[model samples]
Target: MSIKEKIMSDLKDAMKAKKTDELRVLRSLKAKILEKEISERKGGEASISDEQVIEVLMKAAKQRKESIDQFEQGGRDDLVDNEKQELAIIESYLPEMMDDDEIRSEVQKQIEQMGASSMADMGKVMGVMMSKLKGKAEGGDVSRIVKEELSK
Candidate 1:
């Protein structure tokens, strides 16, 4: 099943199970999709591709992560907990994230393939790496690690 169908199926299951938190998160995702679709329609309509949906999901996950960090910093434990739960729900629809080792190895591979040497070569390497690792790795994380590796 496509990601969209999988999400819809899970939403129905969450509803049947009375998983209020899960249902709420899923509804928010649906709303995000609808909002994107409506915005695109105002431009004369466009089909929502799976890639666009995945991008929305990724954005939601990133937002939750930031919110969690801010909540913790502000000492709002309850808000942090809710953001964590929402993040968990958002992650369920995303592709499995790469571990440190995997991301490092992938970054190294791209760096080598692109013949990157000094830090100045970062843009070239990053451009290729981002496309290859899209949705699989966080861009900021990859950039940080790449800079460290290249500076060596």
Candidate 2:
């Protein structure tokens, strides 16, 4: 099933399971998606492509990550826990995450392939990495690791 369809299915399951938090997050996600699609359709019959949908999902996950960090920093454990649960639900729409070893190896390969010798070559490395990792890895995380590797 498509990601949109999967979200609807999961939403039903969450409702059935009496998972209020999960249901809330899923409903918000569906709203965002439908909003985008409606906006996209304003000009014609164009609907959001799967890639755009993934971008929406990534944006949601990133926002939740920021919220989690801020909640932790501010000593709001309750908010942090809520953000964690929301993030978990958001991530269910994304593909499996890449671990450190995989990210490092992929960054290395991209750096070498792009002949990125120093921080000056950072943009090129990022271009390759972003295209390869896309929704699976956070861009900030990739950039930090690439900078560390190049500085070595």
Candidate 3:
């Protein structure tokens, strides 16, 4: 099933199981997806593609991560806990991200392929790496790895 369909199915299951936290997260996700669909609508019905859905999910997950960090920094343990729970739920729908080692290796490969030797080539390298990695890796991680590899 598509990611959107899976979310809908899981939303139903969460409702049936009386999972309050899961239900809240799923409902929020559904709302975000619907909002995205509406914004993209031009004339007829504009359904979001699986890739677009993933983009939405990734953005939501990123937001949750930022919230968790800010809450922790502000010493709001209760809010931090809540954000962590929400982050976990959001992450459940995302594809597995590349580990640091994998990201490092991929960055190295891309640098070699593009003959990127110095920091001046950072932008060119980043553009290719980001497009290649897409949803599989986070931009910050990829950029860090690329910088380390290029500086070597």
In terms of lDDT, the best-performing candidate is 3
Clashing pairs in 1: none
Residue 131 alpha-carbon offset, candidate 2, angstroms = 1.4
lDDT of each: 0.89, 0.88, 0.91
Q: Could you give me the TM-score of model 1 versus the true structure? A: 0.90
Q: Candidate 3, which segments miss by more than 4 Å at Cα?
A: none
| Candidate 2 lDDT score at position 63 | 98
Models 1 onward score TM values of 0.90, 0.89, 0.95
lDDT of 3 by residue, 5-64 (tens): 999999999999999999999999999999999999998899998878988998998998
lDDT of 2 by residue, 28-142 (tens): 9999998888888866776677777888898999999999899899999999999998988888888888877789999998888777899998888888889989877888889
Poorest 10 consecutive residues by lDDT, candidate 1: 42-51
Q: Would you give me the overall lDDT of model 3? A: 0.91
How are the candidates ranked when ordered by lDDT, highest leading? 3, 1, 2
Q: After superposition, how far is residue 133 of candidate 1 from its true place, in Å?
A: 0.3
Clashing pairs in 3: none
